[model samples]
Target chain A: MTPLPTWQRGMRGWWRRDPAFRRYLLREATSVAIGAYALMLLAGLGCLVAGPAAWQRWEGLILSPVGLLLQAVVFAAAVIHAVSWFRLMPLTIPPLGRPGRRLADGAIHAGAWAASALCSLGLLGWLVYGA
Target chain B: MTDPETILIEVLRWHPDTPEAPWWQSYEVPYRADATLLEALQTIKDDLDGTLTFRWSCRMAICGSCGCMVNGRPELSCHLLLRDLAPGPVRLEPLAHFPVIRDLVIDQQDFLDKLPAVGAYLVPAEETEAAAAAPAAPSRQTPAQMADYYQYAQCINCLLCYSACPQYGLKPDFLGPAALALMARHDADSRDHGQAGRRAARDADTGVWDCTLVGHCTEVCPQGVDPARAINRNKTASARDYVFDLLLPGRRR
Candidate 1:
């Protein structure tokens, strides 16, 4: 093949520069934290199956300083993941409005945020009161 | 109103014939409130440096030819005013994620190759036409159907979305935003009946599956065409089809 005289640029530290790309990288990385959390939950389940002492040991490990910090990081990652997911929610579905008057982007964003807040609050209430 | 002042424009320069790699060339151009980056380049070509090369036609955003990197962001040079970017200097470069052919001009052959794979044009249904009625009759469509793909149809094939897409940057095979949006546009149209033929493009490893929904495509769009929405919505469809094909085999089809 004849060599074409064209310059191709490489992608390095792209996320480091643009906020949009940075957020996208964060959103992608949230899955690793989420996966780690799942593994921890599975380990907890295994401990419960082993006996009360094992369960207690697992629980202690989870609630420890390091564990708590890890949990906090995971929680933050999950929140970021969820917010990003909901932001794309409107786009996945058809627009919710008439022809000339379409749903505003502000409305879509607000709706997603509102729904997220309501669900989060409900979950908190359930944890505090019911569970 | 302020007096017109000369502002420095640092443009990335390169040529095939030269042994040297790409470098920046700065030109001082007289700036005005209404003048755009396109006009600045035009000024550079007309008065200052005649060697400056870039592709542009129809100074309006409608042409979609003047997309370039303005200070590390994909923007229509025709649409972005110099006054809004007022300062001593502004950086100009070819659109990212593509091969640079020359100063301020990137290769679009990859995008052109990908567009045909997605079946961007309308494929009409087999005509029964209610016992061979009027051939010239307009295809009637509901407002709701029009709303489905109208935004996607606004795409001018600018390839700014390609520049903005990190996924496309990483993997060149990935059918970038504009092509996928065009695919969705045709699929969503009431007159079109070519979704089945276009499934390979939609479900390929380099298709909608590649999009991470970074949404920079939507952000950088000169027209409000949301390629992220079209790509993501089809992800759901492609995933559903995958599941159905696995479980039901030929039943789903």
Candidate 2:
């Protein structure tokens, strides 16, 4: 006797299949913007090392409409990445707090957001006053 | 609004003997407010069509045998009431990422084979010669200790997680969610000493690494067993083990 045909519903458009999958894909896709921003920063550092004239040229390009637009997109992506990362952080790590008492997931998220806010404010203060 | 007295349940049907492909065959199941999808299926099987086949054991969700795709999402048929999906067509299909055996029944041979492969059971701690000679005693655990793995222990091997997992659909070789969660369940048990033996399976490429944390496994789970969390926690453990194995090979646990 011949073997029966087992129906295989392949993973076609898997990301679109479920809301969770779509969110996962969106979170993963934000890395492209983050990586692009990192590369731009690296290039700016190279320009600074080259000469003052090169540095000025790089600065001008960064202050351009396209550059500002790209930066805005990257910033949005970074915010999304950071939030999603923090939300998932508790899951990846072992249960926090003492043996009997474990930290709530909300506490982890709040702690992460607080830390991020503190760092951002510190960076902003340094840029405005220290510089 | 459709007729309130009856609900249409569209079942994906397949047969080995037939030349036709798997197709949607709708049944008008007499709907009651409290009737579950399992009851509706039973109605179809008992009165409407005897050929319509699906797996169900405990009418409650404990058996985990009644899992199927209800309206494209993996769900326990016994748990979903007809009142919730009222007055319309409810599409039922075999769980995704599994080979269809018949109508609403999937071949769970792969998942069944993976259970022991991950060492989802406990291995007692090595006993001293004197202890070994004595009569065996129960290795007790405190409430706190039990809490560590109690959530994972609730897993009914429903296969809904596997159905919800796109990674399992894409890469069938991936150990998938429920089995990995079971592995974590045993690993977290205070009485279980099987972590060292189960390390190889957990550290493999197709192990915890394959999960991109889509997290639908946790969502679709009727038992509230967070397989995504279990797999990710093991990812951290596996990463630590990797570093330890590299830096101090002999000292690696």
Candidate 3:
């Protein structure tokens, strides 16, 4: 006769308990902030298509403290998303596979960060300084 | 020699014959500076509790048989010195994400099934080439070519990476780290022509696509085999294959 197997229950608290798992959970949660920002932009676009009455209401919502707080949260999540995404680029697309064309992880990370900074700065400049 | 100093060890206990469910059993083990954790278990089995059970063979990291959870991390019991985990009350359990066969032993059938699923073995490019070549002649491999897949080849199949992977805990069918790393190891090998055959396992939703690049597997590996690196690197390869498959369905090289 065979002995019955005894199974141990796994904890759902791994995200809260483990430091590595917590970081992974936080990285995944950034998508919520991105989705929130996308919805906000879509609302603004909808208001524009609906003309002045709807546009005024959208403008009020955009200028509200709550709206500003949401934007701040979204911006913070985007920055984290960008940094973590760039950090993972070295692993996803490695540096040393090719002969005579080796690049360090740091170089890859910095290149990605710089590209992101340039794109962000250009977009900010266009938003504020464009006529 | 003076009477050996003792330390407490808490090992998870379970038996099919016993009515009680799994529970921790603590033992006061005589400490020795040079003794590995496996030695402590041996002492417990020999002197203290003969009923206590765990698996170990090589008494070294090479066999990959002595893997268990120490302080919530997967490590080979034979590889860790008891002196390092001193000050009493070291917690021991079966490897995470695997069903316990008994005390510190886990049923490794899940891992065994995945090995063949991913085409873990190398497939020679030509069956006739082997017949034509001299029996004693060595297959040509430059130092550079050897280095490409050398790191991944060091995997001891300890399932330490599986225990470290949260993705495996969540989705058992994800073809977790060791198997995927082995897949990438053979895929990267210049001599192996098994990449095309392993494509189904690699390209599936449960393949490299499931890994979110947590990288804990690499950190916990006793042999320093970076399965996270292999999984993520293959993500790039998988993406390329996806694009190519779409562009030229029948023209894949």
Best by DockQ: 2
Q: Tell me the spans in candidate 3 whose CA falls farther than 4 Å from its real position.
A: A1-17, A94-97, B1-5, B127-138
Instruction: Tell me the whole-model lDDT of each prediction, alpha carbons only.
Output: 0.88, 0.90, 0.86
Question: For model 1, how does the per-residue alpha-carbon lDDT over A19-100 read when each residue is reduced to its tens digit?
Answer: 8898888898999999999999999999999999999999999999999999999999999998888777777766567765
What are the per-residue Cα lDDT tens digits for candidate 3 across B26-83? Answer: 9999999899999999999999999888999999799999998898888999999988
In Å, residue B97's CA in model 2 sits off its true spot by 0.6
| A19-118: candidate 2 lDDT, tens digit per residue | 8888888899999989989999999999999999999999999999999999999999998899899989999998887646889899999998999999
Q: Is the docking of candidate 1 incorrect, acceptable, medium or high quality?
A: medium
Weakest ten-residue segment in model 3 chain B by summed lDDT:
B130-139
Error of 1 at B200 (Å): 1.6
Name model 1 segments beyond 4 Å from true: A1-4, A94-131, B1-4, B129-136, B246-248, B251-253
Worst 10 residues of 1 chain B by lDDT: B129-138
Better of 2 and 3 by DockQ: 2
- Where does candidate 3 clash, by residue pair? none
Please say which candidate is ahead in lDDT: 2 or 3.
2
Candidate 3 positional error at B19, Å:
6.0
Across A1-131, the per-residue lDDT of candidate 3 in tens digits comes to 67456675575876654577888888989988899889988999999999999999999998899988888888999988988888778788843646334577898888888998899899999999994
lDDT per residue (tens digit) for residues B78-99 in model 2: 9999999987699988998898
* TM-score of chain B taken alone, every candidate: 0.94, 0.95, 0.93
**DockQ for the candidates, in order:** 0.56, 0.66, 0.43
Proportion of native contacts kept per candidate: 0.63, 0.59, 0.44
